[model samples]
Target chain A: MITLPDTASPLYEKVKDYILANIGTGRWGKDRKLPSENELVASLGVSRMTVHRALRELTSAGFLIRLQGVGTFIAPPRPQSTLIEINNIAAEIVERGNRHRSEVLVLETIMPTKELALSFEFPKRVSIYHSVVVNFENDLPVQLEERFVNPSLIPDYDKQDFSKTATYDYLMQKTPVTEVEHIISAIPADAETARHLGIDVGACCLFLHRRTWTGAVVATISKLTYAGSRYSLGSRYSPSKSS
Target chain B: MITLPDTASPLYEKVKDYILANIGTGRWGKDRKLPSENELVASLGVSRMTVHRALRELTSAGFLIRLQGVGTFIAPPRPQSTLIEINNIAAEIVERGNRHRSEVLVLETIMPTKELALSFEFPKRVSIYHSVVVNFENDLPVQLEERFVNPSLIPDYDKQDFSKTATYDYLMQKTPVTEVEHIISAIPADAETARHLGIDVGACCLFLHRRTWTGAVVATISKLTYAGSRYSLGSRYSPSKSS
Candidate 1:
């Protein structure tokens, strides 16, 4: 049973909003069975067509899962990466009710090459911290992160154990990022990235290159690769009124 | 030659920002040769290392394309699809300074199936306008747009010439959309889509499902597919203060 708002919206939209409110408030948990179309029609004093439309639209929006000949249930939550936010992989996995773990493959300080020096805007031949880590969700590798840290920003980078704390989490605590930029591309995985992610060579992957600035110096540059089949980046926001 | 800013930021960052500003303001056009490292160092009164770092970072960021023996030049712009904005494909190509064109494949009134009915939140068996248009960037197929429109909202949907005017552009002019939603996925292309987009079957494609609302009714539902090798969705915005 639900209450409908007396407003200018259409009858079906009111019905849809009522159902969405129930789901958002957690009254109807994930995978929980939803009321039958007839039950909703009868309880909400709406026609069968209106009730059916509401349920169908909800299902299409990823809020409900309909099983033919059985009943409709709430859809399970999927792991989502926010496109506009610099979020940590561990946090994203945990938010989806999954276990998150990591394996540190390479963590060492090295002399910056001309390219690396230019990327960080640091002098050439300077020492920089380089690391490669694979992040897993329920023991399945999801992301392979290759990161370079400016030694001037995080001098004690080698002292931390990355397996226990994600580089993003550690960096945020150590330095305040002033600006960030992301360049996204779909590229086939090379031999090294494929081996770490447990995917075949030349498989398509979502490659994300990120650079973060702290004050005036570039603090970190990272290449985050996700197996295209396993991960997707998403964002939802209202457009500005002017646009 | 670049002017140095009187700020607390590092010398190299100022140099990078100066170069970026010139590019952003269209003072230095695309593919235009940039000053050599020695010239920039002498003009900006900065060290050679500082000028080199600035040039290197700009190249990596896709602003400048560096040639080893030749001089550095402005990089050609890449086509970008905004993840948050409901943008038109024709406009995107034009924004990248490329010509845009389209070929209409399927355009007819279709009786809504059970799934399409649910998607549009309309009663089953109602007539809807369905269209398949392949968008091109200078004759290179980039996007295959398959769309379904609610006939009740746009009764004259079939009357427009879609090759001259995109469905998105037409819809925006016909009605004011109140809400928009996007769902992104990566999947292998089927035979039909492959043939249309000129890609091999089973090749990875970026699949985007979009729904737009006019008032309370879903005005349209669209599935826009892009060849993964040719197209990518991107966005860059400052995160809100609170995560």
Candidate 2:
């Protein structure tokens, strides 16, 4: 039953390493209950106190969750998007060692309607650019993005290949974004959004409405819809007086 | 029908004032469709361009939703929380000129379990303060707050009248919070959370898990659940390289 043969590191660290190795190898799946304290002690040939410390440290690090009277279970992985700044969906997925791709549903120029004119604060007689893209992580759709761009700001917005370059990156490179506003809401998936995200029609979704300005004129306004189970927003900061 | 006798403001401004007066008097309810531009021009004896400008400005200000080919409709109100800072539920409601009250659900000290020990990084042999309170905005339940406090940080943790003093306010005043981490998720409410929020089981909820630190020790961990239809989070900031 005794498995611990390495003595260089501390017992708790070795225990932690062993558990992590198993987790890294997918031997311990998400939400899987760990062995009991006594059972771990017997199998690892470590003291109960050592096993407890290892488990405690792992739990504290958010590697596991101990549910009081219940047993310890694996915590689900949270892919996070910070609210303080604009987050590019493709960068986020690729940064996590996953493949990122986009399905460009609609990409063309449209005559401004009363809605577009009001949103862009421009004349409805002019033309503006509109696009709808569904971003995927490892072939699973996570975000359905609908964006309206001011043609004057990015003249060739519709000409670029969105599948090769993300609209956020393309826009950023095209023009400097001076101001950004983000509004987060939990809403039921609309029909088009649900179809693009491949979720049920009434499924809950984390909806983000972002408006970016280049100096005086609003450059772009985006509506990003994330399926509830796919992604989350996280932030860590110090409390400030103005905040 | 031509009652545009006001000479002080511009024609569009007068038109805006007239429509706003109706809205303020509850004549134009939320999401109510408005008369067509031609109808407004005919009735007010104003030029079509003047009525269009007023409606455009109103839609731009988020007072109305212009559905392109369809007629204009009123926009819904959104009560928002910012993610950049720790938000106190009571303060937000009151700032919006609404009454806020808390229904104290559970307030007691409990012996630390394996879960608490790992979360708080304290020994399981000690006790910790735990409380659950449901906050209401003008008597409608909106937020459910469940918190666990480190006894050392606030010695009189269990003795406070939570309905009178919010846990966030009390904890911050007791010991200065140096750091805070917020993780946001769109989740279906569990039975207990649904009961407290007065929503259907499996209804969508905006869940915020916050952990605060005082000095080197974690002072408190809280789970704040907001009914999806009741509240949303919003923030505006300049784009940063890191974000």
Q: Which is the leading candidate under DockQ?
A: 2
Residue-level error in angstroms, candidate 1, position A91:
2.3
Query: TM-score for every candidate vs. truth?
Result: 0.59, 0.62
Cα lDDT tens digits, model 2, A73-146, are: 77654212222323467877887899999999999999867876787877546788999999999999999999
TM-score of chain A of each: 0.64, 0.62
Report clash pairs, candidate 1.
none
lDDT at residue A237 of model 2 (Cα atoms): 68
lDDT, candidate 2, B1-243, per-residue tens = 859756887888889878877765767675577888998999999899889878977775557788878998876542122233234667778878999999999999998678777878775468888999999999999999999899887899899998999776787667656567777778888999988899988888888888888767889998889999888876666543210
Which CAPRI tier for candidate 2?
acceptable
Among residues 3 or more apart in sequence or in different chains, the pairs in candidate 2 whose N, CA or C atoms overlap within 3 Å are: none
* RMSD to the hidden true structure, all candidates: 21.2, 25.1
Q: What are the lDDT scores of the predictions, listed in order?
A: 0.78, 0.79
DockQ of each: 0.09, 0.23
Model 1, first chain, TM-score of: 0.64
Q: Among these predicted structures, which one has the highest lDDT?
A: 2
